[model samples]
Every structure is written in structure tokens, then in C-alpha cells.
Target: MSDRRMSNAITRPRRGMALEVVLLMLVMFSVIVLAGLSAVTTISRTSNADYHGARATYAAEGGADDVMSQLDAAMQDGIISGEDLANIQSPVVSGYRMTQATRTTGVPVSRTITSGPFSGLYSLNQPIDIEVTARDTSGNRATAVLSVNAQTIPLFQFGVFYEGDLEIHPGATMNFAGWVHTNGNLYLSSDDVRFQSNLTTPDSVFWQRKDSNNRLYGVHINNAAGTAVALRFDSRSLSDPLFKTRSQQDFDGRLMSRAHGVKPLKLPLPSNTPAVTLVEPRVAGDNSMVQDVKMAWKADWHITLDASVFTAYTAADSNTMKANFCTFLTQERSAGLALPSAAMCARIFKPRLDAFYEGREDNRVGSTLAIIRPDLIDIHLDTLRLWSDSAPAARAPRIIYINVINDNVADTRRDFVAVRLRQGAQLPRSRVAADTGGLTIATARPVYVLGNFNTIVWRPAAIIADAITFLSQPPNPNMDARTSWPSATRCTGSSAGWCDVNQQAADMNTARSTNVNAAILAGHSATPNDFMRVGGSQPYGGGLENFPRFLENWSGATHHYTGSLVSMFTSRYALGLWGSGVGGQYYSPPTRQWSFDVNFRFPERLPPGTPSVGTVLQTAFRPLY
Candidate 1:
């Protein structure tokens, strides 16, 4: 009985010890589980915080992007408007809140692009530095800074810029010495053409003609050694990848095409309208988008004809003609007209209504036609210059717009509707650049140049017209050498407006080796495949060689021309086809002694009221907070 009791006591004590040990282990395990749970919770909270912080930073960047977009929109008017400024605010993102948005400057200033594609060109630039702060719903915050530049680049700065397809196929050895760019496709085919500067375009570059003649010729650009190197592979000949590789390696990255990643040089106009509207008059129902850019609307001196009397009416007339025959573009003619005397009116710019001859335009008997109103708007630059001095206080005329309005047009007798600039040996000084600026004459009418023009003093000048014709002063009894060019104070043909060389009939056989210096922005006809099929064997309009229309036999004569040539549209009026110069068709081609004037590279040398194409560049960006 004693042994049995001892065993029971021992067993009971052992059971109690085991139970105590089991309870202690459960307590330790609970402590370990709680610690692990705390660690996991902390990690989860840290990751969420980091993710929200990143989201806030992106939101701030988004706000900054919106500010950039606003800055760009501000450039539509060529300046920042009060409304444009008000529109620049921090955008509301779906889950983020904008804390702040600000800009350093919104005013525009005249400046030159220091870098990028259009460096060395002057423009009106507005620099903006923007900062934005935003926070996500989690209260994370971020800030970003962005710097942008909006620039309005003047078109004259380009040695050659075409808003449409530009084709050049000169038969002779040609050297184009200037930066050349096109907003459209470019076709180059020639015996020998050397581009002395960078050639850029957003479109493709073909080695053949525009009408698909497929006549490949020696087209060249400069290499590092300044030697002419031929461009061999075209878009058709090779694949895109290979062509880009070869052009960049071979041309030293000078020949920029779509394959080489060339971006379009934007024309600062609406996307809906054609670029030619820049030089035309505002017509009824015409899209209003282009009026602000038109040369007619921008002219400081606009002249028009009314009834039988020639009256002047510009608000600036007291400054230009000193109350002579001139009128405001919007002023009515019947209200006590301030017209130039008959003699002076007939001297400056006079409209002729008579019969005349032009070799290219025709269908009438022997190509003769009646001169309708403004069939010929004659401008005597010398006469205007000397006469305008009558009012020295008058501001220098930067741009001159002249067109004709006739009450009758039922004649249908083909005639040359043109504006001629003659006796321009010494042009009037401009009011810009300390009264030493140059002149720019714009008209939707065809432009004709009788004899030498802008050959002296060499001020900056340009002619924006429908078609440009050069009436050479062939060696004649009236004028001897090139030096004997008509004096600024003198003229040929009759002194009367109707009979002077400015308005008389022209002969294709009369031409001399002439030298003219001015930038030419005009139009030319296209040579589509249809042109060859319908016209047969003959090329459409004299390629780039005769872009400046020739009306004389330039067989052995050399036409020395120094200027930029930009053909932006198909000819709307001077619809004459190219002549082989073999059988007498229109006019013979001149031995073109042409060069791009380097003087235009200077801002001071640019013609007054020079128009610009605009762009907004994202210069820099960073995190400000």
C-alpha cells in the first residue's frame, strides 16, 4: 500500500511539470508571431508611402507639361495675350491635386536662335520658365521646373525655303550657296549642281524629276574637305535603313531628309490654308486664318485705283507721298481724294489700259491683248524715292502693296496683269535699323523688272509676286555697258506712263547681260506626269534655271543675279509652259550667273517688315522641389 501511494505522488508531480513547460513554450511562440506581424506591417506601410511619393512627383511633372502646352498656345498670335496667360494653370489630374504653378516670364523679345536646326536666324522669342507643385491623395508632394522658348523666325533668313514641293534641274553647272530647306518633297536632277550649305526637308529627296522623268544626274553636296561629293543612293535605290546610314556617313550629316530624321520647318500659318495666300489680297468668304499673315494686309503703304481719278489715302500718306496720289486701303475714293497730281501720279505708279505683248502668255491673235485695269501697274521706284523726300518727316515705307480694280473685265483679250519695278538703281532708304533699312514690295500681281534693279547701294530688298520677269537691257544705242544701266533719275521709252519701258510692249529678242540683286519669293508651274503627256516631250515651265522668268534671247549673255529664290506655289496666272529654246516658243534660257547673297545673313540687312515662321522649343526641364 505504501509503494502504490509513492508512485501516484511521483506521477502527479511529473504531469504538473510537463503542463507548466507546455504553457511556457506557448507564450514564447505568441511573442515570436507578434514580432513577425509587426515587421510585415511596417514594410507594407513604407512601400505604400514610397509609391505615393513617386505618384506625386509624376503629377507635378504633368502639371509642368500642361504649363508648357499653354506657353506654346500663347504663340498663336505672335505674342502672349492676357487670355493666353489666364489659360495657363495647373491641370487637375484624376487622383492628384495641384499645389502651385508659376512662370518666370511671358513677354517676347527679339533674338536669334543660338542652337538647333535654325541657328543664326533672328526671331521674336519668348522664354518661359515654369514651376509646378502637386500632391497625391496620400499627401505625397513633388515639384518640377521646365524652361521653354517660343520663337517667330523670319522667312527671308533662309537662302531658299519652299512651302511646297521644290524641284531643281538646272542644265548648267550650278552652285547653291545658302541654307536650303523645304516643307515639301524635294526633287533634284541636274548635269552638275553643288549645294554649298546644309540641305534640309521634312519630306523625301528624289534624285529625279517631279514629273517622273527619272533622269538621274550629278547632284552634289559638300564634304569635310569642302569638295563636292555626289549623293549616290536615293530613297528608291536603297532601303530606308541603308540610305540613312550612307547619307549620314558620306555627307557628314549635311543632307537631311526624312530618312535622316529631318523635321519640317514649320510655316507660321494655319494648317488649313495654302501658303500662297500670304501674298494675296483678302477676298470675300476667304478663310480668315491667313489674312494676318498676308502681305497686302501688312503693308504700311497700300495703293489702289478708283474710277478715273488717282487719289492717295493711306493714314501714313502724309509721311510717304506728302498728300500726293495715295489712299488708305480701307478709305473711300469719293471723299475728297488726296491724289497725286496727274504728272506725279503718272510718275510713281500708274495703271495703263491699252494693248500690249508678252511672249509667254497667249492664245489671242499673235499673242496680243488689251491692257485691262492693272494689266500693268507701273511703279517708278526712283521717282517715288525722290518725290517722297518732299516729306522727310514721312516714315520710310517698309512694304508697298499695289493692285488694280477695274469696273469691267469682259474683254477676255489676253494681256499681262503685272506690276513692274524699274528705275530702281538707287532705292529709297527704309525707316528700320536707324533709317538705313531696305525695301520689300509685295503684290499678288505678276512682277516685271525692266533693266537693272537694286544694283547700287546694295540695300536689303525683296520682290514677292506671282511671277518674276527680267527685261534685259540688251546692248543698245540707249545704254552701252552694264555700268551704263539706266540712271535712277532717268528712264527709257516714252516719259508718259503709257509709253515708258514700264508699260510698253516687249520683244523677246531684246536682252543684255543684266545683274540684279534681291530676294525673290514667287510661284512656278508644276510638271506632273500629265504635263508631259498632254504637252508632249517638253518639260513644264523652265525648271529652276528659269525660275526668274526670262523674256529675251539670252544665248551668249550671262544674267548675274545675287539673291535667294523660293517658289512656294504653282503659278496661278503666269501660266506659260517651258520652251525648248530651240524653236521660238516663249523665251531662251540665260547663262545663269547666280549666287546666294551672304549679306542676307545679317539681321540689320533683312528687308523691313520681314515675316516670320514660329516654333516653341522645350529648352530645359528639371525637378525644382
Candidate 2:
């Protein structure tokens, strides 16, 4: 009985030990499972925080991009100023909050760009530093900074700016003393051409044959020697020593001596529309916009004035005559004698007209409204002949505005109106205190300046036209027998062979020295090849060297000219190709004395219809904290 009781006690102790081991194992397993779960939760929370931070960074960058786009648009619209940029409001995107700050200083920061077509020392406006901060829902924050440098481009600053190819190869010794730039290729070939300024192009600069031939008719620099001379200049040097002698070769080896191959650049003018403005002379104390007239035209019309009109003005009181003429025009319009179109009517202020005709002797500045249909009127320079009986030197300026007409008119072959400036004719004038503002003739039509324009005085003047041409002599005065008529066979001989009647007649007149001292904004000749072509036994039309065509024999005379030449659109009538080896046929190449008037350097002396170029450059960008 004692043994059995002891065995039962041992069995009970063993059972209790097994139960304790199981309980300990279960507690250890539970602790390990809890630790694993805690570790997974910690890793998940850390990843979520990182994701929010990345999102915040993206949001900040997006906000910066948005600001840049908005600023660019505003700058292009011609409304962005330092004041406007300073007042930009911060934008909120998605669930992120964005805060922005802008800093602007009036001082301009100068930078030299070395990579693009605009590579030059640019005096950019003060840097505008924009700092943007974005915060996400979980307190994740990111910050970005951007720097914007806006540049105001003065159009007159450039000696020449072309939207298309610029070809300049004068046979005579010519010196261009201003910065020349082109959006297209630059073709230069001359024996003694000196560019005293910088020549830049977005496209390649070619000195080889314009045709597909291997010719040494390339460009020459200071070295008067042949093509083997070593070019001697650096990339930004005043002298360009690069020449593409071979057609198939690249601009490497010796040709890249003093030149820089640059990237393309955007034109400074407005992209949507040509930047054109009509500015009236600022009177002494007139500070309002009312005095500045913004001129616009729509259709076509012709105006004529007889010697009797000026005679009538000379006899009657000037003011009373002007008032009476205005009254007459009003009455006529009411009676349907003249159409009530913008081109037909004009706001004639006697003070302005009197100021224009102040120094003249005839004082024939009268308010006469003459409007005739395009089909009924003769569009020639002689049609504007002032009364020969009147004082020759006392002629007053004549200003007219033509409206836009239907281009699809069946009978009208020319898309633009023709303004012919006859020889020995005087342009209108606007009088200032000491300096005189010369005639400002503007039209949507193509203007042909016959000979010796603005030759009498060195007055500030401008001609704004769709296209401009300088005829050595006058065009055919016959209205019905004009050269531009498609059906006319003047170019086609009576029996055989194509003959240019205008060219033939122009060859007969004597070429005279042309003196033009005015600003010209004309259209670019799209068919420059045709306009500059030299063919036939008497290939007379001298190339661009003689842009103002000469018909007379100007063997020993010099073409003295001073003005700014700006081309904006494709030419409508002056499309003729310029050629080589045709000297003294059409016009004798003059000792070219062309220069950009220094007066244009001043803002006050800028001619009317001048456009502006916007150059916004980026300096630096980085993250803020």
C-alpha cells in the first residue's frame, strides 16, 4: 500500500511539469507574433511618409512650371511689366497648398550667352526670383525656386534683322557698321565687304556657291588674298574669318577660325501679329493718349487735288476755308456723293495740319476729301501732281488713308493698292519746335518711290507700306495700260519672244543720283530670285546693290542714301531676282554711303510704326531648402 501511494504522487508531479512547459512555450510564441506585427506596422508608416514627401516635391515643381507658363504668356502679350510680375498670386493645386514669393530689383544684370543665335552680351532686366512651397496633408513639405530674366529688345538696336535668308554681296567696297541678324541662312560673297559690326544667323552661314557647284566665289575677310589665306579671328571677334570654299565640306578645319555655330532663336517680334504702331508727334504739353492716333486701314480708294483747290485756299482765310471744306465734305457724304467709309472720312484738326505746313510758303493745307473707286481712278504717281502754277517749293504734305477692299474682286488682279511716289515730288511734313518731322506716308498697299524722295531736307520721316520699291524713273502714267495687268502683252512682243515693256522703257531714261533720308518699313520679296534675275542682252535691273532701280546713265555719280531699312512681310510687287556681272545696265552701282542714323538710337527719335521685341531669358533655378 505504501509503494502504490508514492507512485501516484510521482505521476501527479510529472503531469504538473508537462502543463508548465506547454504554458511557457505558448507565452513565448505570443510575444514573437506581437513583435513581428509591430515591425511591419513601423515599416508601412515610414513608406507612407516617404510617398507623401515625393508627392509634395512634384506638386511644388508643377506649381513652378505653371508660374513660368503664365509669365511667358503675359510677356508675349506686351502687358507684362515689373509691377505686374510682382503682383502674381500663388496657386493651390489638388490637396496641396502652395505659397509663392517674388523678388525684383530695378538694376539690370548683364549676361553673356555663348550657345545660341542670340549669343551676345545681353543686358537683362533684374532677376525675378520666385520661391514656391508646397505642403501635403500629412505635413510633408517641399520647396522650389525659379529665376526669370526678362529682356526688352529695341528693334532699331539691330542694324538688320530678317525673318528669311539674307544675301549681301556688294561688288563695290561697302562697310556695314551695325549688328546684322537673320532667322535664315546668310549668304555672303564679296571682294571688299567690311562688317564693322557683329553678323549673326540662326541657320548656317554659307560662303560657297549659292548653286551646287565647287567654286571659290566665297566670302573674304580682312585678308584681300585668295581662299587659301588663314582666317584670323575668334568666335566673337568683330571680323568674320570663316568661309565655306567647298560646297560639300563642313565648317570645320580652317573655315571655323573666327566663327561660332549657334542654335536657332525666336524672333523678337510678336508671333501672332506684326508689331506695328502709328505714332503721332507729341505736342509740347499734351500728355494724354488722345493726341496719339492709332491709324488702321481696310479698303482701297483714290484721292485727287487740283491747282484750283490750293488757289482757293490761298485767296480765302485759311481757317474759314478749312472749316468750309469740312462742311462741304459732310454735306456731300449726307447726299451720298462720297461713301461713309473709314478711308473716305478723316478727322482733320487744323492745328496739326497748320503745324505740318507752317514753314511752307503756299500754305495750301486745306481740308479736301477726294475719294474715288479703285476701278475709276488712275493709280499712278503723276495722278498726285500738284498744280504746276502753284509755288513749287511751297507745296504742303498730303496725307490719305485707304481702307481694305475685297481681294476676290473679279477685275482687281493686284491684292494690294499701289502708291506711286513720282519723281520731283515732296512728301508731307509735321512741324516740331526745332526739329521737323517729315512726311509719314502709310498704306497697306505696295509703294513705289519713283526718284529722289525726301531729297530737299534732312527731316525725320517714315514710310509704312506692304512693300516698297525704288524705280530709277517713273512708272507708266497710263492707268489702263499699267504693267501689272495680267492680260497685257507688253512683256510678250507683238509677234514673238517675251519682252518686258516696263523694263524696256525704264532702260531709256537717264539714271540719276538718289538721295533718300527716311525710314523704310517694307515687305520682304518672297521671290527674291525673280526680283534679282539678270537676263537678256540688256539685263538692266541692278541687284540689291541698286535696290532703287536706276534707268539713267549714272556712270560717275554716287547714290547717297541714309535711312533704316526694315522688312516685315513678303513683297507683293517688288519680286525681282538680283544677279552678278550686270554693271551699268539698269543702274550704276554707287559708292554706297549707307548708314544707320544714330538719331534712331534715342527713343524719342524712333520712327513711327516701329515694333518691339521681347527677350525673356532664364538665368538660374534651384530648390529652396
Candidate 3:
């Protein structure tokens, strides 16, 4: 009985110990499970925060992109107009909150660019930052910043800049010494044509002629060492597989087009807006957007015709109208202008005209071409006209804006249509550099420049016209065409509309090799320009070598021209075909002695009212959260 009682006591104690051990293990397991659950919850919360942060970051970046696009649009419209700034709104990203985009381009700075394609060129630049903040509902936020710059660059940077398809098919040995760029395709054809500098285009570069499939030899472009090398193939002509290898074989990247990833050079105008408006005189009813860019708005003297009466107005209104152009010239001679007398002015410009002419336009017979010459009204602001920001006024005119408004279109002759610049060798203002804004003639009409111009003194001079025709240099006895022309030079005074056509042709035929030193910004005649495309063989528009219209047969002489040549638009009023002459045939090609004047690269030397191209470039990007 004693042994059985001792065994039961021991078993009870062991059972109690076993119960305590099981309870301790259960408590430890519960604690471990709770700790694991807490860890899992914390990890999940961290993951959610990470996801929200990434979303916010993405939204911020997207908003930044949206701002960039808006800025690009603003560049097209001259940057930051009242309406343009309003268009920059934050983007909508799903599940992300966006803050209103903001931009700041402090003060604009003007300086010479020291690198890149525009190296050594001066430009006005405004650097600004675009910032956008984005947030997620989970309390995560991110901010993105994009650095950008807007640049206003002078237009004459290119030696030759064409807005449309450019064709250089010179028949003679030609050397072009400046940078050449075209917004359209480039047709490099014919033999012995050498481009001395870089050639770029936003379109394709062809090795064939614009008029036919004929591809002559001896067409070369510049290499890095400034040597002319044969440009055999490019992205268009070379094998697609070897384009990267072959294109860099010779030119050293100097010759490039869109196929090589060249972007289009843009102007600061609305989409599809014509750049020709920069030269056209602003009319009374022009839109507000065009006012700031139009060079004619700054005309020192305004000339217009009304009721068969012509007037050179000092201001926009008739109250500021000077006098009858005929009487005014005679009076101006006493005022030290040395203008033509009243009778001479009337006889030179005004005449009875046939209602219409029988000559064809664009080479069509019986087309009844509008009589184009009698409408050549002209003016001589041949005196010192000092101009100031305030009413200091112009002592002599440096800028003349001429607009011919006939309103007599019903008469079929299209009267008062063109302006000619004569006696301009010694323009009104002294030819010196003081930022005095040199001689600039702005007109939208087809302009005729008679005799050697701006050559004698040659201080920054420019002619902006729809089409510029360099008339044969008049015979000079050391004189001015307006005040001192002999009877044989040009039809003047009472010989106006009745000028002998045969005699005029004789004068043009006798044109001597002349020198014209001025920058010419004018229109070019367009052709079908569809050679080797869907259709083939379009009529060529005289090519770039003959861009300055000639009217003589100089078998042994050269037309010495030195300046920048820019063609911005197709001829509007002067619709005559380039090949067709004044009386069926006008001129034989002269030895083209043309070169780009390097002086234009200087900012102080740029002609007054020089139009510039606006561009946008992204500088940097960063993300903050």
C-alpha cells in the first residue's frame, strides 16, 4: 500500500510539470506568430508607399513632358504670348494628383554662341525651367524639372537659305563659299558645282537634276578640312545597309539631311504661317499677331498712291502726307533732296495705258499680261533722316516702305504695282557703322534695282522684296539715275508708258558687267520640282545661279555679286516664268561672280531690321520627390 501511494504522488508531480511545459510552449508560439504578422503588415505598408512614390514620379515626368510640348508651341508663336502661357496645363495621370505647371525664364541674355552648329553666331537666349509636381492619394509626391532655352537667331547665318526645294545646277564652274541650307529637298546636279561649306537640309539630298534624270559629274561638297570632295552617295542614293558606314566616308558629317536625322529649322510663326509676311508692309487691318515681326512697320517714310495721285507721307494719315509726288520732287530739290522736277516725275511715272496687253504670262500667248512697267512708282529719300526712339525724328530716311494700292484692278492694267530703287549708290544716311541702322528698302512688290547700288560706300545694305531684279547698270557720268540721267539711259519723263520697247531691249542688251554689294532677301520662282518623284521632268526655275534676274548678253563679262542670298517664298505678283525674257528672251547667263560676304557674321554689321529665326532646345532634366 505504501509503494502504490508513492507512485501516484510522483505521477501527479510529473503531470503537473508536463502541463506547465505545454503552456509555456503555447505562449512562445503565440508570441512568435504575432511578431511575424506585425512584420508582414509593416512590409506591406512599405511596399504600398514605394508603389505610390513610383506612380507620383511617373505622373510628374508626364506632366513635365506636357510642359515641354507647350513650350515648343510657344516657340512657334514667338514664345509666351498671352494665349500661349494659358495653354500650359498639368497632365491628368490616373490615380495621381498633378500640380499646375510653372515656368520662369528670367531676363533674356544676348551673347555669341561658342559651340554647336551655330558656333560663333550671336543669338538672344532666354533660359527657363519647367516644373511640375504630382501626388498620389497615399501621401507620396514627386517634382520634375526640365531646363529649356528659347533662342532668337539672326537669319543670314546661312550663306544661302532657301525655304523651298533648292536646285543648284550651274552650267559654269561655280564656287559657293558659305553655309547652305534648305527647308526642302536639295537637288545637286550639273558639273563643276562646288559647295565650299557645310550643306544641310531637312529633306532628302539628291544627286540628280531638278529638270531631268540627267546627273552630270563634278558635283562636290565640303569635308572637314574644307576641301571639296565628291559626294557620291547618301541615305537616298547609297545602300541602306551601309548608309552609316558610307555617309561618313568622306564629308565627315558636313553633308547631312533628314535621312541622317537632321531636324527642320523652324521659324517663330504659327503652324503653316508664311514667313513672307516679315517683309510685307503692315496694312491698316492686319492682325495683331503680325505687328511685332513685320519690318515695314518701322518704315521711316511711307509712300502710297491714291486717285492717280502719289504721296510720300511722313505719318500714316493724310495730315502727315508730304505732297503730290510730282510736285513734291520739284520742291524737294530746293530742300537739298536733289529730286526730279514736277514735270520730270510726272513724265517718268504717270502715263495713259492700254487697258490690257497681248503678251502672254508664264509663256502663254494671248494671255493679256498686265502692263507691269508703267506701274513702277519710285521715291528718293536721298537725304539725312535721323531717327530716334522719341520724337527726335528722322533728319533723312534710312528705311522706306512702299506699298502700291491701285484699286484700279477693274481697268485690267493693274496700276501702281511696283517700286524701283534708283540713285541709291549714295543713299540718304552716311554709310558708316554706328548701329545707325543702315539703308533698308522693304516692299512686297516686285522690285527693280537700276544701276550700281550701295556699292560706292557699301555700309550694311539690304533689299527685301517679293522679287528683286538687278536691272542693267545705267551709263554713268559719275551720277545719280534720278537727278542726272541722260536721255538714253532709261525711259523717263513723258516717255513713261510710251517708252520704246525696242529701245528698252537695246539698253538691257547693252548691260555692262556690274557690281552689286548688298544682302538680297527675296522670292524665287517655283517649278513643279517633281523630277524623279511620281511624275518626272519639271521645268526648272533658272536655278540658284540665276536667282538674281539678268537682262543682258554679257559674253565676256561677269556679274560680281557679294552678299547673302535668301529665298523665303515663291513669287506672288511677278508670275512671269524665269526662262521667258522681257520680250520673249531677255538675258544670257553671265559668269556668276558671287560670294557670301563674311562681314554679315558680325552682330553690329547685320542690316537694320534683320529678321531672326526662333528655336527651342532642352538643356537638362531632373526629378525630385
Best by TM-score: 3
lDDT of 2 by residue, 24-74 (tens): 999999999989889889888989878888888888888887777666655
Each candidate structure's TM-score, on Cα atoms with residue i matched to residue i, is: 0.77, 0.53, 0.79
lDDT of 1 by residue, 1-625 (tens): 6999989988999999999999999999999999999989999989988888888888888888887766665554344444555668767788877855555475677777886556656787877677788876667888888887777777777778787777788876777777788877777888888888877776777787776556665899897567788877677787767777787688776777777655555444654556678787756665444566787776766766442222332242133443333341222222232334556755576443332456565423243453322345557777777765555335346677766564233443423456788667677765333655678888877888866678778888889989898877533434323244443322454332112344334344545678788888888866654322354443555667777887656677778888888777877767665663223354567677777888877767787656666666778889965
When summed lDDT is taken over every stretch of 10 residues in candidate 2, the lowest stretch is 351-360
Error of 2 at 154 (Å): 3.4
Shift in Å, residue 376, candidate 3 = 2.2
Cα lDDT of model 3 by residue, 536-606, tens digit: 77777877886777655555666788888988888776666666533565556777878888888787777
Q: Report the Cα lDDT for candidate 3.
A: 0.65
Which candidate comes out best when scored by lDDT?
1
> Given candidate 1, what's the lDDT at residue 226?
79
Q: Name the runs in model 3 displaced over 4 angstroms.
A: 1-45, 114-120, 235-249, 259-273, 306-374, 378-393, 407-416, 430-433, 475-510, 581-585
The candidates, ranked best first by lDDT, are: 1, 3, 2
At residue 540, candidate 3 shows an lDDT of 72
Instruction: Give residue 292's lDDT in candidate 1 (0 to 100).
Output: 66
Q: What is residue 550's positional error in candidate 3, in angstroms?
A: 1.8
Ranking by TM-score: 3, 1, 2
